[model samples]
Every structure is written in structure tokens, then in C-alpha cells.
Target: MNRILIVDDEAEIRESLEEILSEEGYAVSSTSSGTEAIVLLRDAPYDLLLLDIWLPDRDGLDVLADLASLETDDKPEVIIISGHATIETAVKATKLGAFDFLEKPLSLERTLIVVKNALEARRLRSENLEFKRQLTLETTITGESVPAKALRQQIKLMAPTNGRVLIYGESGTGKELIARAIHSESPRHDRVFIELNCAAIPEDFIESELFGYRNSAITGGPAEKRGTFERANGGTLFLDEVGDMSLKTQAKVLRALDEQSFVPVGAAHPISVDVRVIAATNKNLEEEIAKGNFREDLFYRLNVIPFFVPPLRDRKEDIPSLAREFLRIFGREYGRPRVEIAEDALDLLKQYPWPGNVRELKNILERVLILNPHVHRIERKHLPRLVYRTTGRRSDDFSTLQQAREAYERDYILRKIDECHGNISRAAESLGLERSHLYRKMKTLGISIRESVS
Candidate 1:
């Protein structure tokens, strides 16, 4: 139900509003003092506030100032009520964030209509806030590895600044996530975040995508189209795979960054914008510049703040946590909640070198859940064969005999545990060792028991 708080010094007026709004199916609360209304608002959320100008305790305008000062997003839409209604007073109330004004001889029909509209506006505002919150969550960089922690700290320090950022990472290493994280934490967080993939767009269309066209710049395009830069004004524009941009396009981007304005195709006047550019690429930009493929001026302009996202293989210890997070995410999405991964399965994941990085791991987990919908618990055998079969390290990959032996033992024990369905006793018997001895060996090997099995 839509909630309304009525703040009127007149007892009869408050009672009348309460009764009428209650009949209209609104959850209504009334207070005679502006002070009490402020307290009520602080205590709970209300969709609308019917505020009276003549409160015995305090002036309604002062109350409006207090409401504006309150650091909260759930502020109510205020409708000002006054017996001595004046144009100046209405204008002042409006300036103080009042949604509308009501006169002494209130019109029942008009009041109801205004109240309904205010509530609808409140609902829309709430939805927008929720949508932005979801977007922020999606950009969260997960993991506790050193690189991950450092990246988050770097984002926190650099995000508040307007300086351009250039992210460096291998393909599928989450360069876009890093860009988004920076934008989400930046001063322009509340503004739009626009992303354009330089490599994805064809050379012919890339320029138009970055700086929109007017008057049907393309043979049969729209009359006028806003480009990523214009759409991201007062916000952030993320250019993914920026190294792939042609020198011609790079020159234009350099100019836009320098002047904070651009002339759209087929347009005479250049539009000015306050945009923060964040670019990311898998290729070494310095090498690109050396080869004359990338512009040095553009590189220097965007490289003010540089970020590197480490590949998954470099942070293999974070795989267990990342794997679990992906499983939980995909589990809820696939209608298979409480999905558990066997320790043996996790060991295989850790052993494999993820050339595709975190993105590949996420895809593999989602694929596993999709292919095995009926299985609540994922075992080693459930993983793709490539994870284990191709994960073995060559003898030369190991520096010492001890390292190679430990790797072999760990793999053998994991295999036996998987074959025995995680039965410690049977695995120990098969290995000709006591259960207690096997437990000690498993502990020495750093194998954790994450799932219970027969």
C-alpha cells in the first residue's frame, strides 16, 4: 500500500485527511507538529507527505529545509498546505522540493489526484534507484587474491578523480569489469555509463558509433543519433579494446578528450560534453604505438591512470572462492540452489591453467550446472574432461623432485577419493593406509573437505 504522512496543526483537518486517504486505500499517519512529522519520517518510509504551512511547533518551510538536508533516498514527496496561499509561498515551497501546493479550502478531487500522482512518481524513483543498485552489483570485482585486492584499492583511490583511465589485461581477464568498477565508484557514478567496443564495430561504423551522426549520415540511418560520447555526458564512457581503433578514429578520440566536445557526422556545430573516458585493451599499447598502430598522443591522454587485471592462472589460489561464487550465482539462476562442489572437483579446477581467465571459469561452471540439472552436488567426474586430462604438468614444469612427487600424490589421492565417492575409509583401504594416516596425508597436501559424501 502507498504510505502517506499528514502533518497538519488542525486536529479536524488531520482527522479528515486520514479518513479520506484511508478510504482511498492508503496507509496514512497524521502528526500535528512539524517536529513530530520529521521524527515519523526518520523512523519509517512514506511515499507522500501532506505538510501544512501553519504548524504550531515549527514553520513548514523550515521542515521542508530539514527534509532536503536529510541524507536519505527514501524521502517522501511533499504537498504543501496553507490557509493563506500566496504565489510567493507556493514558489518557495516548490523550491524547497514540494511536489505541489494545496489551498485552505482543499479540493477533495484535486487533492486525491495530486496524491496519486506523487505516489506514482515515488514508485518510479524507487525503481530507478533499484536498477542502478543492480548495475553496481554486476560490476563488483570478486576474489581475495593480491591482484584483486590491489585493483579494488586502486579503483577507490582513482575513481573519485576525473582523470582518464586505461586498463591493461589479457583477453577475457575482466578489463571491462575493471572499467565498470572505476565508473561505479567515481563521482559520476549516478550518471550514465556508456560502453563501446572498438574491435567489435566495423571500421566504417566505428566513427559514427563514437560520435553520432545527424541528418541521416549513413544512407538510411536515423535522422539524428546520439553517440556514446553524447550519451555519456556528465558520466563515463568505456572504450573496450581501444588498441583496435584505427589511427583516424584515434585522432578524433584524442581531440574529443582534449576539448570535451565533438562534431557529429553531417552536423555543423560541435556538441560540448563533460565525459570521463575509460579505455581498456588486451594488447600492449606501448607495442602498438611502437608499431605505429596506436597514436602516442591518445595513449598519453588515456594513460593518466593505468590498471592491470591479473589472469586467473597467476592467482590460482583464488579459484576455489571464484568457483563457488559462480556456482552459487548460476545455481540460483538455473533453479538449482544449494549447489555444492566436491573438494576433488575444486582440486581439478586449481590444477588447470585458465588461459581464458575468470570468464572461462564462469562459463564452465554455468555449463556444468546446465548439463547436470538434476545433480545437486558437483563431483570431479562432472567437470569437463579437459579440466583434468590436459591439466597435468610436464616433468620439466616442476623444478624439484619433491614438488613433482607432492603433485603426483595430491592428484592420486584426489582420484582415489573421487573413485570412492569421497569415502575416506575406502580410499585409505585402497591405498593400504589407515584412515587416520590418510587424513594426515590429506591435511599435509592441503586438501580441504568441502562436501560430505558416503
Candidate 2:
């Protein structure tokens, strides 16, 4: 439930407002003085604050001023409620971060509406803060290696330009991270960064989402809907897994690039935008074009500036740094104080082929942290068994080695299947094996379809 704080000197007013807000299903608190309200706010979390200008102790404006000095994340919205305040005071309150001001005679309906609006604004601010936080942690490129340094330099150079960039890498190689970094570092950083995973979005709704429809009488009355293109105006639009974009959408995208504009679905007028396109794909565009699954024209348009993100194998030197980063991140996430990886554990990680890349590494570390808890150091025994067997470092016994190898393969295949929701074709593609081969392997490994999934 949303928490609200009501501040008023009058006992009747505080009680009445508290009753009204509580009846409306809001968690409400009340204080008679600004000093007490400030103390309460400091101690607790509230979504919105209802403040009276004529307070016995400190002025409400002073409270608003103090709120302005605090960090954005912890600040709750203020709604000034004053019977004896002037328009000038109301304007000043608004200028000092008040969401809105209500007169002395507060109508329950109007008060509720303003409260709802304030809560919505606060929710949006919270969400944006979370988005930015995630962007900083997950999107920021992390490495001091030569390849990573080069990648950063490339982003700095190409980000300023309006040319579209094609990011190439394997799955979980942080291609989206590169895309976000380029946009965040660019001149259009203030504008929104809209992302669409071409592979994930269904083909049917691609057009509608990329170029929104005009809400018409036939379709649904003439209300204009902004698509991702419009939403990303004066900003960056990242098309993830661009190679997976259907041929039809690819052609439309090519046209949009050529014209620098597009009409919404059912709209007559074309809307122009100054959006920078950033395309990423795990697949090789040349091969995709050869297979005729991707458009050649679209490929050329998006590949104006190519950025190839090296796979984990190519950047093995960064494993220690990356592993330590994951250890720190996962440790905090799993409520562990501080966790570190032992030398042997780090060596085992370096030896494994991280086919799933950074994402996989983060996931595995999270699992380890959850299992181990607040432990200080992670050792080789804490490592997953597949890491050893898959790295071709098995024991002397042929039978034991074979069993280990089969176990590793079984675990790998199962993970892939689970990732793709047990879709055989998708899992096979991820494993770089034919569907028939995967089926045979599953059988040979004694992985029963029913028992395994259940």
C-alpha cells in the first residue's frame, strides 16, 4: 500500500485527513508540527506528504526547502494545503518542489485526485531511478583490458555521429550494454533510450510498436499513439537481435532510415525524427543475408558503424576482474556482506568456456552466493561441476572421465532447454547442434523428457 503523511496543526484537520486517506486504502500518518513531520519523514518512508503552510513550529516552506536538499531517491512529493496562504506562497511552494497546492477548504474529491497524481508522479520517479540504477550496474561496460578500452574509445567516437551502429557479438556478450553505453555517452543522452529485441517481439505487432497506430474509429477514435520511434526522438533507439527482425519489418526500417521519417499506422502525415539507431545481433549479418533471413539494404543501413564485442574466450584476461565484479554484485544481491573468490575458483572460472558470456557468469555467481551465503571466499569445490568437465580437464580413469563428460553435456543441454522453455529447436540452435543430435544426446544421457522436465 502507498504511504502518505498528513501534516496540520489543527487536530480536527489532521484526524479528518487521516480518516479520509485511510478510508481510501492509503497508509496514512499525521503530525501537528513541521518539526515532528520532518523527524517522522526521516525515520520512515512515505510516498506523498500533505503539508499545511500555517504551522505552529517551523514553516512548511522550510520543510520543502530541506526536502530539496536531500537525494532524489528518498524524497517524497509535497502537496501544500493552506487556508491562510497567498497565491505567491503557493507558487513558491510549487517552485520549491510542491506537487500541488490545495486551499483551506479541501474537497475530498479534489484532494484525492491531487493525491493520486502526486503518488503517480512519485511512482514514476521511483521507477526512473530504478531504471537508471539498473542501467549503471548492468549496462556500463566493465573492463580495463585492451579490447574493452578499444570498445569504449569506439563508443566515444561513433556516439557523437548520427550514423547507425551495428553491434556484433555472441549471446550474453553484453551487446545491449554497448548499445546503452554509446547512447548514454552521446550528445542525446538526456533523451530516452528505447530498446526492442527483434527476436522476442512477435512479427505481427512489430509495425504497430515501431510505428504506433492512429487510434481510429475502425481500429479502436483518432487519438495519436507514439511508437518507439517517436518515443526515442532526439535520442537513441536500440534494435536488439536485428538479424532476427522479419524481412517485412526490416524493409520498413530501411525505408525509415532512408527517409528519416515514418507515418504511424493509419496516419496520413509522416512524422520526422532525429533518432540515432543502434542495432545489435548475435548472429553474423553476412550469413543472415546469405540465408535471406535478413535484409541486405537494412543491413547496410544499420552497419554504417560496426562494433564487434569480443566473446569471453577472446577476453580471457579480463576473467579475474569480471569474476570479482560479479562476486561483489551477487554478494550484495544475495544479502551477503562481502564475498571473494579463491585463487583456485578463479582459475577454474578462467578455464571454462563461457559460451553464455557475461550474463551466464553473473547468473552462476548469483547461484553460488545464494547457496554459500555470507561466506568470505568461494573455492574450487564451490564451483559447478560442468566448469571442470567441459574445460577438458578430467581425471585419469576413462570411465570416470566419460561419466563426467556426459554429466557436463547433460547439464549444459538442460540449461539451454530451460532457457528456451523446453523448446527443442531453440535449445538446439543455442547449443550449435542439430535438433536430431540434441534429441539423440538427450536419450543417450538418459534424460527422460517427462521425468527430466517434471
Candidate 3:
């Protein structure tokens, strides 16, 4: 429930407001002195404060000034109430962060409307704060490799500018995260950050999605809808997989970038927007341009500042940190907070070439957490067979013959078990060994029967 505090010298007025507000389903508290109201605010949080200008202990405006100095997340929205009506006092109250001003003869309907609006405004402020916090957490770059450090430095240098950025990376290398980091550090950080995946949308509807339609522009669509360009006005617009955009859409997008204005479908007038464009693509745009698939002009417009994000294989040294970060993330998500990875398991992770990059590693960790709910510390045996089986290591990669022999045996045994669909007796029979001997070999190789089967 929304909490309201009333600070007025008049006992009759305070009691009446408290009763009315309480009946309206609000938790209301009344105090006859501004001093006591301040004390009450310090002790607890209130959504709205109804303060009277005429106070017995202190001036209500002075109390509002004091509120400015109070450092609290749950600061109340002030609604200044006064018997003496003056334009100057209302302006002063507004300048001092008062949400609204009310006269001596408060209308029940007006008071209720103002109170509701104040509470709603406070709720929106809280939500916006929470959203920014989450965005910061999600966009953090979690690696200590040379490439990772260079990318961070580049973002810091380029984010403050209005130049267009084009990110080049393999799929799942975190191009979108880099875009968001740039937007968060940019001058327009307070504004909206809109994203549209060019490849994900159908070619037939890409134009309409980029520049929204008006008055049933499509057959059965809404009457009027704003596009990403319009929604991202005075902010940043990220176009992911820009290489996949058709030549026809490319022409219109180029014009929009040049003119900073575009007419929505079925609309007569053009809407101008101040938006910084950031584009990302996995395919080589230069190759696409040469192949006559992508437009050269659009590529030039978005490639003002180019960023290359290396794939996970190139940054193998960061695998341990990345693995632990993923573990922490999925652990908290799955309510398994103290989960830890063994060093040997991390070594195996670093050996494998991540085909799906960071995204694949994250999925594997989450899967491990979900499948092994009782396990606190993740060991090599807890990992899936694919992780150790398909490492694709050459004999020279191993320092000793024993290491090479053990790796070969581990792969061969896993293949047999997999071929038998994880049947231990059948696998042992095919290998010309007893079930107990096979189990002993698996234990030596750090392979779990349950993991292989599951």
C-alpha cells in the first residue's frame, strides 16, 4: 500500500486528511509539527508528504529544504499545501522538488488525483533506477585477456562520441553487450536504447519495423505505431546483423542516416530524430558488398568506428575467469550460490575450442547446475562427455606419452559407452573387460557413469 504523511498545524485538517486518505486504501500518518514530521520521515519511508506552509514549529518550505539534504532511496514526493495562495510560493515549492501544490480548500477529488499521480511518479522513478542497475550488471565485460582489456579501453574512448559504431564478431561473442556498454557511457545514457535485429525480421516487414506505420499501413495492424527510429530519438539505435538487411531496406536506411528524418508508412510528414546508430554483424560486409548482396553506402555510414571482438578460441586464457563468472551467474539463478569449479575441469574447458563461444560455455554451466542439483563443487566427472571427447588435440599438444595414452583411452572408452547408449555391461563386453574393471577405469579417467548416461 502507498504510505502518506500529512504535516499541518491545524488538528482538524490533519485528522480529516488522515481519515480520507486511510479510507482511500492508503497508510496515512499525521503530525501537527514540521519537526515531528521530519523525525517521522527519518524513522520510516512515506510515498507522499502533504506539508502545510503555516507550521507551528518550523516553516514548511524550510522542511522541504531539509528534505533535499536527506540521503535516502525512499524519499517522499512533496505536495505543498497552503492557505495563502501565491504564484511565487508555488514556483518556489516546485523549484524545491515539490511534486504539486494545493490550496487551503482542498477538493476531495483533486487531492485524490494528485496523491495518486505522485505515488505513480515515485513508482516509475524506482523502476527506472532498478532497470539501469540491471543493465549495468548485464553489460559488464567479464574477461582479463589482452583482447578483453583492449575492447574495454576502446569502449571507454569511443562511447563518449556520437560516431556510428560497427562491431565485427562471430556469433555469441557479445556484440550486443559492447553496444550497450557504449550507450551506457555515452552522453545520451539517460535516454532510451533501442535495438532491432535486421536478420531476425522478415524482409517484407523490415522497413515497417524500422519506420513504423500509421493508419493501418499494414492490412490489419494497429492504427498508429512508432518504430525503433522514432522510439530511439535522442538516444542510441542498435541494428544487429546489419549485413543481412536487403538492398531495398538499405537505401531507405542510408537516406535516414543522411537526413536524420524519415516518413512513417502512410504518413505525409517526416519525423526527425537525433539518434546514434550502432551496427553489428557476423558476416564480412566487405565480402557481401563485393558479392552485390549488401549496400556499400550503408556500410560506410555505419563503419565510422569499427570494433573487432575476437572469438573464444583466440582468448583461451580467459576461459577460467569466464567459466567462474558463468558459474556465479547460473549458481545464483538456480539458488546454488556456493558452487565452485575444479581446476582440472577448467583445464578441460580451456582445451576445447568453443564453437558457440561464450554463450555455449554459459549454457553448459547452467545445464551442469540444473542436472547436478546435489553437487556443490563441479569436478571433471560432472562435465558432459562432449567436453572431453571432442577436444581435437594433436599428439604434439601433450608433453608426455602417458598424457597422450590417457587422453586416447578416455576418448575411446567414452565412445564405446556412448555407442552402447551408456550401457555399462554392453560397453564392458564389447571392450573384452568385466563391468567392475570398466568402472575402475572410468573412475581413474574421471568419468562418471551418471553424466555419460544423462
**Order by lDDT, highest first:** 3, 1, 2
Models 1 onward score TM values of 0.62, 0.58, 0.71
Worst 10 residues of 2 by lDDT: 389-398
Top of the candidates by TM-score: 3
Evaluate candidate 2 by giving its C-alpha RMSD to the native, one decimal.
11.2
lDDT of 3: 0.90
**Predicted structure 3, TM vs. truth:** 0.71
What's the true lDDT of residue 42 in model 1? 86
168-262 per-residue lDDT for model 2 (tens digits): 99998889889988888888888899998888889987998899888545544446668899888889999988888888898889988899899
Q: Report each candidate's C-alpha RMSD, comma-separated, in the order given.
A: 8.7, 11.2, 7.6
Kindly indicate the candidate among 1 and 3 with the higher TM-score.
Answer: 3
lDDT of each: 0.86, 0.82, 0.90
The predicted structure with the larger TM-score, 2 or 3, is: 3
lDDT of 1 at 24: 95
Query: What's the lDDT for candidate 2?
Result: 0.82
Instruction: Show pairs that collide, candidate 2.
Output: 215-222
